[model samples]
Target: MLKHPDTTNAATSKLAATFASQQQAARAQPYPDYRSRLHALTQLEQQFKQQLNALAAALSEDFGHRCAEESLRIELLPTLQGLAYQQRKLKRWMKPEKRHTSWLFQPASNFIQYQPKGVVGIMVPWNYPVFLTLGPLMAALAAGNRVMLKLSEDTPATNQCLQHLLAAVFPDEQVAVFSGDAKQAADFAALPFDHLLFTGSTAVGRKVMQAAAANLTPVTLELGGKSPAIIAADANLAVSAERLIFGKCANAGQTCVAPDYLWVDAQIEPALIHAMKGAFTRLYPASRLQQDYSWLCTERQRLRMRTLLQQAEQAGATIISCAEHSWQHYLNDGSGLLPLQLVLNLPEDHALWQQEIFGPILPIRSFSTIEHIFTELSTQARPLALYVFSDDKALQQRFLKHSHSGGVCLNDCLMQVAQDDLPFGGIGASGIGAYHGKEGFHTFSHAKAVHSKGWWHPGKLIYPPYNKNWLNTALRWLLRR
Candidate 1:
């Protein structure tokens, strides 16, 4: 989507100016010292802490009524944790890693130095705006890169709050925030950035990649797909249902890594669904979903979920609403309070099964045997996250080795991305590259090789134009392998 020509021109001009200014700043301080980086991270951390209440309130307002406490717990906490982690480990991460020189290159030293990639561009999505913005921001800042963030326009209130907080903590050159319409965001992506990272749906991710390709800018895409969960024949029904429900219901299942569907043993489908529905009711009683639970961030998303459900129903799928009241009663009331819904007997050609369901909907497909699950999964595009529930370690190992996903949880869901030490991303269509913790620092930096050779000059032996003896000897020794 784009705006009028005049709007596009204005947005392009503004973004170009910002990029130029940031480029200048990056040149002035190509690499910040460890102490300077730590201090800057500390400053941002303090500002984030001070504005926690406001940020949470802004998230609530932007989503029409998100639980402020939930915002703090889910968004503010992770952002702060990542900042502190980077601050503590920045010095060590900045040091050069010594590499072993081959015997042929004796008296030479080889090492890798992580250098800043100059100005970086980060595109934030509406869900978990604060955390997503800061997660990569910390990595870029830790690696000493100037950053420009294009926050989602769907989240105006949270974007305003982030703009104020970022402005108070860092200068426009060191860190810039852009909250604009789709046209401006499109223009921002097209800018020639040193590196670009986008977090959104696969369809939009492709467009972002296309725009970045114009500048030859490398991208780290964190996209969502049909992340599925498997319930093994021997799995614990109660624990699996509890964990799966939590993963699917969190943020009303708007999370990129949330479980999109479940492949369960046909014999246990009824029991598993019953346990999940009960667990959800306990988490957010059907009677009080409007008072306690989060709604979809926008009405458009709400409508999409509704349409998907209607489409599935039209195709003769059996629908099971988790709450006492149907999803429509809560989600359709202007507020997007949707409850967990289970779809069974859905046709393979149904739209719900074909795409990522970024709402509180789970399609339950029954598998007769473990092999049956693997056979079907092997034919589909790799998903972002995979969940398996079983006590059998060998079965777990089999899934681990056979399936390819961005991340996997042996007996749980959504826990893989929660850790700061882990690299979070997808593969294939799900995404391109990952960035979190150590991986993130390198993502925004270049691993420049620093090789040094002493004055010993051992290579003088092979300098002659005609050195038959040396050539034969070297070839004999080298070609022995």
Candidate 2:
């Protein structure tokens, strides 16, 4: 159903008014004390505990059969851990950071006070809805900022559940959640927030930034790109295959940081493929029908995956389906289920190679040398995450030094984002700014510089007197290398 233009404008105006109210409230308190922030976080955690099962079920229904266990493991656990980490570290993070002053300014002391950035706007994506929504919310709250969350319309069930959970603990003036269609999301992005954070496609991120630009709002975009996993020649094929399968198959590869493709040494390509097939078979004995496997969130996503596979196959790419069950059954059942597909030797200009494949399709390519891998990656924009499977520390370090990415996982995959202590974000097309741990606190904060001077200042010598005497000599000496 198409929404009326007048209705859309009215909704936008309503959201803006709410934002203004939140901003006013934030100004009244300005900086929330440690105790207040801790209390808010504790309330959030308690609410989650009470509604954990409901949240899991809501998320499952939204995803057309997302495993409740997967939702709890991937979404709820990480969010709870993030909340605990913030509660434990908020006091220390709020302390003023003392900075050393130069000898020339000995009488003055300098420090940075972290202040909240008024009202913050967060745009949540459908994939990992709970984790993404609450993860950033935790950081914003820890930094003592009022929050306005725009939940994804695709996950209506989860959105309603989240709205109820948040309302139980916080008033609209402190935290608000909006649920609507794309028009509402666009209006939400256009809001003049003190700090705005969005998680979604690179294309939408550009639009969000453009909208926020009119307000001069600082934005932290958590976007997705074609993240790649590089398998070293010396790495154990079995181990790499196991980890890669887990990372890629989790959530049916709808993750933004999921391995979009694999770069393997030409010699190990066959062995790695064999290992991956074995890994997938063991992981999902019934293939797409396995209870552990999550369906694509919607029919559109399933069709998009199918189109990518068909395009790759028609363009002379080798298509390998790792389905131990009948594919026709899944299609006839209308389960939105898709088998893990490996596309090999795809053309450089193929659509699957160009776009971020946010589904259960994994494109595998072989490279002869490390330089070749670097050369290939150099042509693309920085990815949100990069995975390297290698036993050699030197090789891993070299790759780390040469390659650019938001985060890198060595000898494993996807676990880098699970660490609450580490900052998770991307570079270039992948994302802008970071949010997690202390970095997250800083992102949602303004580090105001404070300079304290004693009553007896050292500037008496350099007062407004028009004389080039001892002070001038001292200045010249100080300026000298």
Candidate 3:
């Protein structure tokens, strides 16, 4: 059962003690214990499927009218797919990788073994709670490490559901979940786990990294920033607008990797904006409010977006609110959904242009050429993802070569994250390590190099001989080789 205490001090002590006990137990256990742990995780694969469905339902209720299709696509599918992929690939991933030895070390054999890093702490974000939690949890479990998950306080229903589900299937000493306000999260971060993984905003990621540093704990930060979408002059306007708009508005533009702004070739800026407005109008018609758009997940985010929009207007930006069609009846009962919007012809210095706008509002800017767009993006902090829509292969290659971002989608946006086979991560500020496929497994595993050697291959040529002749001979032989 989940524990609750009247006093904050008592609760903190209790939770800290529980976490400490788990860490100690995992460390003190024998090799066989690791085997059992792996076996339990294997069993959890089947059990978690049903739990995921229930958890998704809980999450949908929490978000208030989040489409089941979107939840399944984003959350359930990714987790189950990760579990299945790991189950089939882990044995191969565990095999010691042998390396060829140099002629000088002929008698020695070298291999790199994958070892567990012990307990791992996962701090899951609220936007995609299930996948964010399971993504890291799976990696930790696959590498034979125990896990302690801290769910976002913003997602209370999802957090409670995850806590209940995990408690049912595993002992507290194996895996546990904790949830509370931001202060509680700060306390959780202070605990020294073998490794800590955090997925959230860039600002919060810094705090997490600093806290983990106090205990010398290794960290993998998956943070988000202002990812830009570049639409070239020669691109297919309809296809480009369709895909980019779909990605931007899919989660009501709340995604970290969502295209933050558009850098359109100046020649096509007018046409692209028209296409975007048309695409949004078709999906979220004013006639069908509930069926068309999803609500902003939290009131704080809504207020933030509202403030940004207001700021952009004050700065003389053109706010082209998409004409609402006919989806009004569904939203009559107080849904927080807003019409998809485009902020066009904004000056570079506008407040909305300065930060990551995590809403349906897309700020459109015009660039004269590819080089100019590249220079503009290069000046900003590396974004989580960059979308370059172009038919010219040469232009695409050139842009990629000069740009530095977390990930890129050629002629598209956001879909690159779905290609499970590829490694996904940020370079500098966006994030540290890649996860997904074998990369995820390796990220959570400790690879140790081992070398086996015997006395049979003794070097008699230079065995501490105090002679000039021996030294000369050795030097001559090394130079000749």
The estimated TM-scores of all candidates read 0.97, 0.97, 0.92
Q: Of 2 and 3, which scores higher on lDDT? A: 2
Residue 61 lDDT (model 1): 89
Better of 2 and 3 by TM-score: 2
Candidate topping lDDT: 2
lDDT (Cα) of model 2? 0.90
Q: Model 1 residue 470 lDDT?
A: 64
The runs of at least 3 residues in candidate 2 whose Cα sits more than 4 Å from the true structure, single-residue gaps closed, are 4-10, 287-289, 326-329
- lDDT for model 3 comes to 0.79
Order of candidate numbers by TM-score, starting with the best: 2, 1, 3
Q: Give the TM-score of candidate 2.
A: 0.97
The CA lDDT of each predicted structure is 0.90, 0.90, 0.79
Estimate, for each residue in 362-469, the C-alpha lDDT of model 3 and write its tens digit.
888888867787777778889889898988899888878989998999987777877667777887789888888788778877888998888876455556655769
What is the clash count for each candidate, in the order shown?
Answer: 0, 0, 8
